[model samples]
Structures are given as structure tokens and as C-alpha cells.
Target: MLLVLVFSLLATCSTAEEKAPADSTPLRLTDVSTAEAFINSAEVVVVGFFKADEGNGFKEFLAAIEEVKTLPAALCSVKEVWTNYSINSDTITIFRKADLHQENLQLSKIKKLDSDGLVRFLTINDIRYITEYNQASAVGLFQSKVKVHLLLFANRGSTDYKPLKERLGALAPRYSGKMLFVLINGKEKANERALGYFNLKSSDLPRVGIYDGESDKTWLMAPGEISIERVQNFCDSFVTGELQKEKQAGESEAKNEL
Candidate 1:
């Protein structure tokens, strides 16, 4: 009887241990670093890392990731910080800045590769230099024979803002050499200045404007519409000389100043 009781207790303990939920696995820091290195080599990287809890509530994470893969970036990181992500062969993960920071590793260099695999660092100093050069070139002020699109929005109140930003970010390469600016109206003063500069009214909560770079005129491409195709077509027309007269006039004025 004593032997039987002891056997029964052991069996019960083993069963309980087998049935209990296992502890969540912590994110592998080394894997994150390796993945980051892999991403930095590609032309487009979409990272998709989310907490298991956050992911459980949103089934659209995968879909959101797939959408961002269409853009041009060297790398994308999509793994959870301090937690594991359910990624698979079909998963489209874009790089997330949050997970990168969680590793406590400073980004020493970001190597952007060309089609032939030649690498170049996309550094902060490089970005600043490019920006300064572009500004000095009056790249924004010039009438682009290319349509310039601007998405002006406030990031304070919307849960959808991140996904939206990601989607818009993917479209960056398509608008390359064409003026594009994401006006994040996070500050009252900045928002007011943007409003005054653009002559926007309160009714324009979210607006997408298309500017003729050569003409120095802007048109309401879509006030609230985030149509990538429409914006692309608008830009294509400028490239094709639909706005040549306006561009020439602006260039003439600019030349006179010199």
C-alpha cells in the first residue's frame, strides 16, 4: 500500500509538469545581431518584431509586414526584444528600430550594397552630408519636372500611424529625385508653421499634396487619399514633360538670381 501511494504521487507530479505551459523563450541576442547584419546587406529590409502578447491581439502583423517589403531599404529587422517572435518562411519582416536598440549595441556601420554587392556605409554623417548637399542644390525649391509628394500628418493620436508610416516609407525609392517630405506635426509650433506655410485650414487634418517642382506650384493630389499609384502617375507626368513650361519658368528665375 505504501509503495502504491508513492508511485501514484510521482505519476501525478509528472503529469502536472507535462501539462503546464512552458516559460516563453527569451530573444536570442546573437540571432538579432546576425539578422541585422544580414539585413544591412539587402536593398530592402522589412523588420517585423513584436511581443507575443501584442501579436496575439493583432492578426494583421504579417499582412502589414508583406506590404512594407515593396519599399527600398538595406535591411529590415523583425524580431522581438527580450522575447521570441513567430517568424516563418512566408513572413515578411521589416526592420524595427526598437528591437535594434534593445540589443544595447550601437550601429557601428550600415553597409548599403549595390546590385553587384559592392557595399557602402549609409552613416549619419553621410545622411547629413546628402541632406546638406540636396538643400544647397535647392532640390526642394526647384520645379522638378517630377511631381513632389508630401504627406503631412499628426502622429499623436492614431494607432494606425505606425503602419501608415511604414507603408509610406516603402514608397521612398519610387519618389527618389522627386521631392518627398513627411511632415510630422507632433508639435504645436511646428504644425502651425506648416499650416501657415501651406495655407492649410483646420479641415485638412490629413493631406497629401503634389507639387510641380519645375512650376513651383502645388495641387491637392488627394486631400485624405493615400493612393500610391495616383501619386506615382502624377510624378511620371512631370518626368514626361507635362509640366515642362512651369519648370523652365522656375529655372529661368533661379538662373537670373545667379
Candidate 2:
């Protein structure tokens, strides 16, 4: 299937209050007039330039743009812009234009699904689909015979994220039970609360976690470490050993009574 790439312009400008840090040059948007015209003309516009620094700014920018390519057709109309450096007045801005025709052709190749199926697919893929704050508490994931009640967190930005996702995806076939994968943004308050409970913090932008339903015990799955073989093995050890031991202990009195 052909993949559709949607380009959104992500730009960051530095304000007077926020001084540009030393060693990093400010980025400026030079061609606002042309950019406005381009934005108006194209269905999707991704215009942003990063400093060629040791942090691999250009690589991060390109990866962000690549994400737009996988976006479904419904999201094509939105323009995405991003920049690591604050834009100053004098800095020269460089913009890259994504070919709309090519994007449309790629989009055409993707099979469209109905609303319900799309929602389920997105949820299974660990995409955040919360419409309200309360929905954040909804029970989504499971481990062994127990329901895992925790919000989903995923780091979609990491270059190594795809392999982890693929591994998690395979879990659905092996375990038909409900398994929630919440996409977490560490900066968000809800995510912070969830992570705090587990005494964990992620310096990375995206990460995943599994929370126990009753005790609220949280098990964090590190971003690069998630895989079908690893996850399944972990679940088996936890459930068949720890969880089973607890259950058996709880049932001992009943067995004695019988």
C-alpha cells in the first residue's frame, strides 16, 4: 500500500523576554509573505529548519516531517511547523515544501476505514484519543488474567519506536484480551501524576506504562526495550509467579474451609 505523507509547518520564534541561549543561533522566518501564500495554496505545509548542531537538529526535523507522511487523509489539511531554536527577527528562514500531488497519491493508497474501526485501530496503535479529562482514567490494558487500568503513554518521536510498536502489536493476536497502551507526554500533568506513582521519570518525550487495576501498581516498559518476546515473557513471569502466588494465598482459607 502507498503511504501518504502529510506535511505540517512547525516554526518557533524567540520573544524578547526569552533570550537566545549561548552557542545556539536564533532562527528567523524570512519569507513570511511567500509562506503565507504557500500555506494558502497547499493542502498541507511543513516549513521549519533546525540548526545543524551536534544534537542532530536536522535529523529530528526530518523525522517529524516523516511522521506527517503516515498521517491519515483526514489530518492532511492541517499544517505542521516545528523548530528547536527560537526565531529572532534577523535570522534567515529556510523552508522545505512537501509535494501535495505526491502526498495525495500516497494517501490514495491507504485503505480508509469507518469511524469505529478507525478509533479501535488508533487505540490499538497506542495513539491518544481522549476527548475529555475523565476518559484518561478509563481501563485500557491487561496483563495475564487481570485487567490493567492505566492511561496510555507512547513515545512516537523516537527513531527506534517502530520496532517496539510492532512487537506490542503482535500481542493482540497472541492475547485476545484487552490491552491498553497509552501514549504519554512527559510534560503533561496527567502523565506526570501517573509516572510519579511509579517513581519513574522519562527524559524522553514518549514512553509506555502498565498500571494494575486494584492496587494501582504501575510497571513501566522502557521505550527501546518493548518487544513481543520480551513483553510476553515478562507477563508470564509476573502472572504465573507473583500474581498466581497472591491468588493462591488468598484462596487458601477457602480451600481449608471446604
Candidate 3:
């Protein structure tokens, strides 16, 4: 099985390299030291391993990766160290911040891919780095250098969140480098503190809020319903300082907590 796998991988990489695009430049890692150094330094990077003589997979991967415009991200192709790391076949791994074992993102035995399929996978899985929000995530978002626009929902598993999620996903790429888009579960116990901090309740479920990290102030949307245009206008108004500061107090708060 191992021998057959190796041969099949080598064939895929060879075919991918032949048609590789010229503009895609994947950094080559020489050894363990270089790999560690590069991965640690990059805020986010896509790392892949290929046989010394086979590299088509890396090319296709790079072409798809290049379409994303977020910064602090790069592509790396490494060879000759698979045995040292127990990595079999060509595998694509995502390293974020300083962690070397963000295992949920490691992909191996990859089938052939077109640019669209690969890009769509990355976007949907948030490999481009849109942060997930919850109670524990509030502090991190508050400390972020970039302003945060949090999409609050009843729960991730509910179909009710589909429309809002789809809308925000479209804007995530556009605001990628400029701001952070976070998804928060309003009904979860983990988010109790966050909900209190924002003065939100279950009745006000499925909403949007903007946190200005620089000023440590947050504002909630007034519109009863969510739509792409309304959310975009809210973001625009916040950015332009045109949104009103006063908000009508609601009963979303528990009296004892207030």
C-alpha cells in the first residue's frame, strides 16, 4: 500500500508541475531549521511536501492560493524531509501563528483540483482566517489591532443563520486585511459574558455588532432584520462616524446582572 501510494503521489506531482503557472512562486525549504523558522515567522502559511523530482501539486496549490489577497500569508514547498517528519505522500498543511500542529487543516492524498474548487474550500473552511466568536473569544477580539465586526447568531448548527453567514462570508474577503470578521453564537453558554457585555439577549438573536478595538467601544445594529445591504451600510456608517451613538435600552439584560 505504501509503495503504491508513493508512486501515485509522484505521478500527480509530476503532472501538476508541468502545467504550473509562472507567476506562482512557492518558497523552497532546505531543512528542518528553515521550515521551523519560516512557519514560525509567518502569521499564516500553506506548507506542502512533495518528492524531490515531483512538484505539480505545489504549483496548482500556489495558483489557487494566490487568488486570496490577505497578507502575512505565504506558500512553502518542502522536499527530502518526509521520513524525518513521518509525513507520507504530498500533504498540504496550514500553519497559523506559531503553532506547528494545526491538524484540522492538514490535507493529504489530494485528488486533482481546479482553481475554483481549491479556492472555494479555503474560503468556506475559513483557511483565510476569519475568527470564530464565543465567550472565550471576546478578549482576543477586544485586543485585536484591527476593528471587529461580529455576526451574532442563535447557533452554528441552526439553518436560521445561513442567510447572514452567506452575506458575511462575501464581505470577509473584501475586508480581509482591514478588519476582522467574527462569528458568535449568541445562545451558547460560553457566550454569556459576551452577550452581557454587549447588552444583548436571546430575543435580539441574529444581529451584528461592531467593536472598535482602538476605542474599546461597541455598537449594535438597530435594524430588526439582517441583509447584505443593511450590514454593509452599517459597516459604512461606523467607518464614516455617521452612525448615531444613542441606543434605546432594551430588556435583553437580566436585572440582577445589570
Candidate 4:
């Protein structure tokens, strides 16, 4: 299985490299150190491991990246770097820091070999530590293996919006696979529904909420300042199942009272 996957991505190129549009130039990653730096340099990065720059899917990789425009892409022909990733030969991989996921795309295995399909691959795996909620990005967020989300609701142009978003981005990696931190722009009319689902309004901007996909349960932090310590405690409460237990206990108490 492994052998079939790593089979040289370049060797299977039946066609010459198509000229990748110059929308974005892919960085050349020559060594393991450079590769590591590049991987950590962004919340998400697309790295193509090919035997040569002009190899199979190389052009497609470049062209596909041009279409996405949000991710940084790199090309690594070094076998040393390939081994570090546990792939033998050539594959395009999405290295995401948020969930610590390495999504691999092999050209030989793909039925369609075109820039369109490659673009889909890049977008679908574009999950980041702090992904803004949107139509295109929502695909990646919902499809993510991590089912839980820590949501930050803030009006886009508000005073504290960017600062709160950055604060959560730095905290996201700490939770990694446990939760996907998302920014919900309250100003966007489309997001009004999300705010309503949490029984919140735009007036209640700059709030924190947790949604557990597995149980379809939603939690909103008790109205207060959205401090890092408070948010961290809320996340910890969720992870420890304390939040669920508390809810259940409250229900039990109500039943007793009745």
C-alpha cells in the first residue's frame, strides 16, 4: 500500500508540465530545516513533494494554488524532507497547524488530473487555526475531522474584532484537534442565523461559544468579558465533560423541584 502511494509523482507524468499561471510562485524547500520552517510559518501550507519541479502535478499544483490565493505553497524535491513526512516519493500534502493534520494528495491515484481537481484538494484541506466563517471556508471547517468548535462572535469592523481574533488564533494551537476556533462576523447578514442559533444578537457581540458536533449541543459562555483565562476555562470544562455534567445536574435539580 505504502509503495504504491510513494511511487514517483514525476515518473507518472504522461504530459509535459503545463505552464502554471503566475498568480503565486511556489517556494522551493531544499532541506528539512527549510521545510520545517515553512510548515510552521503559516497556519496552513501546501507542500508538493516531487522529484523535479516540472514533474507530474507540479504544474497543476502551482495552478491550483493560484486559484485558492489564501494558502502558501512550496515545492520540495529533497528525499530527506519527503522521508520526514513519511512519504517515499512524491505527493502534495496540506500541512495544517490547527488540527495537526497532514492531508496527502497523490496524482496517480486521482481519476482526474487537472488544475480544477487540485484546487478542490487545496480548498477542502484549507482548515486553519483561526478560519473565518464563510461559504468557501465552511466546507473545510465542517469536513474537518475535529468535530468540536470554539466560536468567537464579533462584528467585523468593531474596535475589538481583530484583536480578539488574533488572541484566539494564538490560543487555538493549544487545543489543536480538540477544538476548531472560528471567527463569526456578526455584521454579515448570513451569520445572523448562527448568532440566533446561540440565542445571541449582534448587540451581544464579542462573545464566546462552544458547539459540540457529536452531541449537537451548544454552549455559550456566561455573559462576561471574553478574557483568555475565561475562554481557556470554558474549553477545559468542555474537554473534561464538566459542562455536560453541569447541564445534566441542573436538569436533575429542576426535576426534583417539580
Model 3 segments more than 4 A misplaced: 1-45, 48-129, 134-144, 244-258
What does candidate 4 score in Cα RMSD to the true structure? 10.0
Candidate 3, 62-162: lDDT as tens digits: 66668743422344344444555566666655554411234223345446555676555443333323455532234334433454454544555567765
* Best of the candidates, TM-score: 4
Q: Compared with the true structure, what per-residue lDDT tens digits does model 4 show for residues 1-258?
A: 212211211122121112333337789998999999999998888888889778878888888888877788888888888998997766999999888889888777877789998887786677777877765566677677898999998887789988998888888888998899988788776666677667778998888988777777777777788888998999999999998788666855533432
Give each model a TM-score.
Answer: 0.36, 0.35, 0.47, 0.81
Error of 3 at 237 (Å): 0.7
- Per-residue alpha-carbon lDDT of candidate 2 for residues 92-211, written as tens digits (9 for 90 to 100): 122212111111112122364233433332222222211111221122222113344223344334665445445554453343233333334444444454444444555643444455
lDDT tens digits by residue: candidate 1, 13-73: 1000012321222222346666656455433333323333233312343333233223223
Assess each prediction's global lDDT (C-alpha) against the native.
0.36, 0.34, 0.52, 0.78
Local error of candidate 3 at residue 132 (angstroms)? 1.7
Misplaced by over 4 Å in model 4 are 1-23, 251-258
lDDT of 1: 0.36
lDDT of 4: 0.78
Query: Top model by lDDT, which number?
Result: 4
